[model samples]
Target: MIRLDTIKDIIVFLLAYIPPLLVFAKFWREKHKNIIVLIIITLIYLGGSIFTQNLLPFILIIFDIKFIKSAGTSYLDNKIDNTYNKTKFGRDINSVLKFDYNRFKFNGRNFSIFSALKLSAISYTVSLLISIVETILLSRLNVKLEGQEVVSWMSSMQLWRFIIIIPVMIIFAPVVEEFVFRWLFFEKIFKNRMGIYLSALISSLIFGFAHFNLRSFPILVWIGIFNCYLIDKKGYWYSVFNHFTFNFITTMALLIDKI
Candidate 1:
């Protein structure tokens, strides 16, 4: 029999995640026409999350590339130009903004792969260190990590299963998460009134809470902050690249352990 607490947890999760998406729809896009695309993507995310082990559905995200490119990339140029400087939307990138190789002409560049990897390394290392510290502290207190089950399941996946999830982990997941947390939540929803530091903090906390993992909450928040910093100083694609690279490294580590 299903327990009442389990049902309650499900209700709570739906309330937190579902309502936010509705509110997010209003604040997420510059144009109202794009809300349909946003709603579809969120539905895809929900379905994909429910079957995370069977990750092939995530490849469908590639089909959604039109959403990002059509919405975002028409205006970006190597030169910052008057428009790039004037608009917050131009400066910020959403999820799945392709890092076209032809970009980065002369002194002015759209996104820097090398710089992204460097910062992603820093963010990834910091997350690992924080997790290690948290684990030690929690162990002393005899508290079991609520998040460990998910990590353990991921790490223990069979080779074929792990291989199937690679694209989802590196590309689709990063794109979607960055779009939601960084672009929609941090920039559009909160950053206008909250300023950089506080907005980043609140959004990062929300990002962490969305994962429903108490032990890794701080790590997720720190990663969120790092992504916000990238979007602030670097560009939207920078944070997307950092997030993908971070996930790549983590997914590879898990793959190696499974092997």
Candidate 2:
């Protein structure tokens, strides 16, 4: 069993969950541009996922730009400073995070790049191992006297399981999340070395919180940060494949759990 005491577990939960939730709630009510929203979401996410929280992870999981009703005015102060400036480029550049597909360049020369594959495999493997450790640790925690109801709620989702969610997780989530979090969010805010680390940390936290399960938050953050690194280093497709691999592995684990 995971030998953590009740107090220690609570401390971990609070550290990981509070910051991101504060950030998310801070900006959720405001009106901002897509770029701004993207930046704040990433920041808030980082804050929230630092500590594992039971209810907060679910909120983090489904929280994407599309699901957000509209952009609020809670503009990212730094991102806006960099993006909207008086230059020859009179209008904002939408091409940076091109939503349309034709703009996606599939350079034939880089078709069999080993670095990309290696990065994806290594990161995915690391996340899988981390998640396994977290699950085992969580299973050992003395079930919180007050958390049984919450666990029951989560258990209900197990009925449908991986078979129903793998496609959505691997394909749809990677496309949408990478576009919003990395292409849009990281591009604007993460300009310098400090910004890069901050962006990766925040993006990972948000990714972790989105999962809503305390036991899984650590793994999600690990995966999220790794994906952030891939995106920062190799661009969009790298992050996508890394994300797909992590989810695929998780889906397999979930399936195995059924047996």
Instruction: For each candidate in the order shown, give its overall lDDT on alpha carbons.
Output: 0.64, 0.52
Give the per-residue Cα lDDT of candidate 2 at 243: 74
TM-score of 1: 0.64
Q: What's the CA error at residue 10 for candidate 2, in Å?
A: 26
lDDT of 1 by residue, 1-259 (tens): 9996577556534633343444344335643457678878778766654556224232432333333444345434422544443335444333223242122111126566777778888988898899899889988999886764446668777889779868877886676666567766787678888999999999899877766678778988998999998876776678878888877877888888888
**lDDT of model number 2:** 0.52
- Please provide the root mean square deviation of candidate 1 (C-alpha atoms, Å): 7.5
- Supply the global lDDT for candidate 1: 0.64
Best by lDDT: 1
Clashes of each: 1, 19
TM-score of each: 0.64, 0.50
| Model 2 C-alpha RMSD to native | 10.9
